[model samples]
Target chain A: IDAVCTAHGLSVAEFHALRARATEAKTRAYCPYSNFRVGAALLARAGEGEGESGGRYVLGANVENASYPVTTCAERVALGTAVVEGLHSGNGRGFRAIAVSTDAEGPASPCGMCRQFIREFCELSMPILMFDKNDTFIVMTLGELLPLSFGPDNMGVKDPAKP
Target chain B: IDAVCTAHGLSVAEFHALRARATEAKTRAYCPYSNFRVGAALLARAGEGEGESGGRYVLGANVENASYPVTTCAERVALGTAVVEGLHSGNGRGFRAIAVSTDAEGPASPCGMCRQFIREFCELSMPILMFDKNDTFIVMTLGELLPLSFGPDNMGVKDPAKP
Candidate 1:
């Protein structure tokens, strides 16, 4: 736990708080069809505040379509929400961390598209924490999921260069 | 135009042609990473020793994954190719009759969880087609897309007859 906090430059208390939010969000998952509910929460850098919460974007499970093909995963829904919110905020800062929770037997991992979309939007070093029902977790970097990925560079789209 | 056939009741020529060769599948969609690409061929069905060709099964594209969360759009890719082949097969299965496509514009119209999966395995119906580049499509059936939709009554799990 300490190592995870240190790697992400997050204080111990702050990391715990993010995990709590993720757990709460998990209950909101709309998975009546698959019965595989998932939840995600995104934490942004401190200092940007408009509402009671500052620099934090929380996303709950939202299943949009009945046709399986049209269904969006919890992680993507959350990420999309965060991206839209972040863009509107105009801070130009990427997410600092993301926490995920699932009810699978072991740790439930995100699908391939979720990781790609997350990697595309965040920095290589962004911290991602995946927790199982038992509260045990596997913490890693977004880059670990997608090594040598095709990103903005391939598309020739300029990302706001990292400061 | 002579290879494919479809039928609401009469077995449209174009869709029927592709339904014969359901074996020896097409491209393997190795989507261990999120680079969704797939290619499929809707074969024309033929009678045993009769040399009758009018059945088809569409092939799929390759959808990749950088990580587990993001995966390829196999359903759309296969569906698209099927639609293209259906039109050219010209056995008389119209394009607009198809409901799903396996392409890249949006999420592939199929997922592992839906009833379409059951339709794919059962071989209950004929003239299966998928969509092409445009929102249009090829011919196909519920059995082609879904092998066994969760049948609540099959396992004696739910007795709708009594309730």
Candidate 2:
């Protein structure tokens, strides 16, 4: 807990709040296919964790479909909302950090696609906190989840060039 | 157009129907945030594209949220559904191909993250068809997009243990 808190430049209480929010969000997920409930929360630069009103947003459990190829994981749902909101707000800075939790026996890791997208905004060292129902938690950096991953930059996309 | 038909083992007319369905699914897209609606259709097996109902399924657009940290791209939405349906049907085989279309200007490609997940279910040579307005199109295999990717084989995970 202390390590996760320090890594995000957050207080222990703030980090706990983030995890709690993720747990709550998991309940609202629409995952009828996998029955794998996941929840996530993001701390925007100007988000609630920063003591701001609208900067931080929370997203909860979403589902994947039987179409196999059509499923969306919980982590990407949270990140995409942040990106869309950031674009709409006219300040394209995406989420500064994210937290995810699942009801699985062990911590559910973010999918590979999400790991790549997370790198698009947060640096490799950006903190991603994950927790399981057992109260077991692991905090990792996006870079660690995907070593040498590709992002928008690799496609010649820069922040200023994004739509 | 010809390449897409050939890749999916479909006739030109059949591929057009899938693309049309993909185009129509865009209408139901929940991209209230981005307003850049997208949709997808999958040709499940070799015989499906030819209208034999060869296990093909259709999926549409769903967006992600910043607070959620998991975004369900239209393509992923369609493909994930295919995965579950395959298992439930006891086919045990994954989707053979997927096609995606979006309202964004020019041809928009799947993000790196989606590519990784797509590779998880299909072989390296699995075809992904992308199309844009004006009949502009591009074709590529999973290998072309992900190049060298990591999958269950890399993690010592056997097919029986895969979800």
Give the alpha carbon lDDT tens digit for every residue of A1-163 in model 2.
Answer: 7866776677776687788888998898887766668898877666324345545655745667777657776777877776666632344444556788887656666766776666666766677778888768877766666653445553445743244
- Per-residue CA lDDT of model 1 for A1-163, tens digit only, reads 9987987887787788777877888888776656677888777664445443456656756464443345677777887886676542245456778888888666766676777777667787888888888888888887887788778788887654244
| Model 2 lDDT, full chain set | 0.66
**Ten-residue stretch with the least lDDT total in model 1 chain A:** A60-69
DockQ of each: 0.09, 0.12
lDDT of 2 by residue, B41-150 (tens): 87665332344555555676767576444557787787777667652223344555667787654556676667766766676676676777654667677666655354
Model 1, B7-124: lDDT tens digits are 4443454333322212112236564333343334434333234233434445554454333333334445555565455432233332222233343554244455423433322234
TM-score of chain A of each: 0.87, 0.84
* Model 2, runs deviating above 4 Å: A47-55, A87-93, A160-163, B1-163
Where model 1 places Cα greater than 4 Å from the true spot, the runs are: A47-53, A62-64, A87-89, B1-163
C-alpha displacement of B148 in model 2, angstroms? Answer: 18
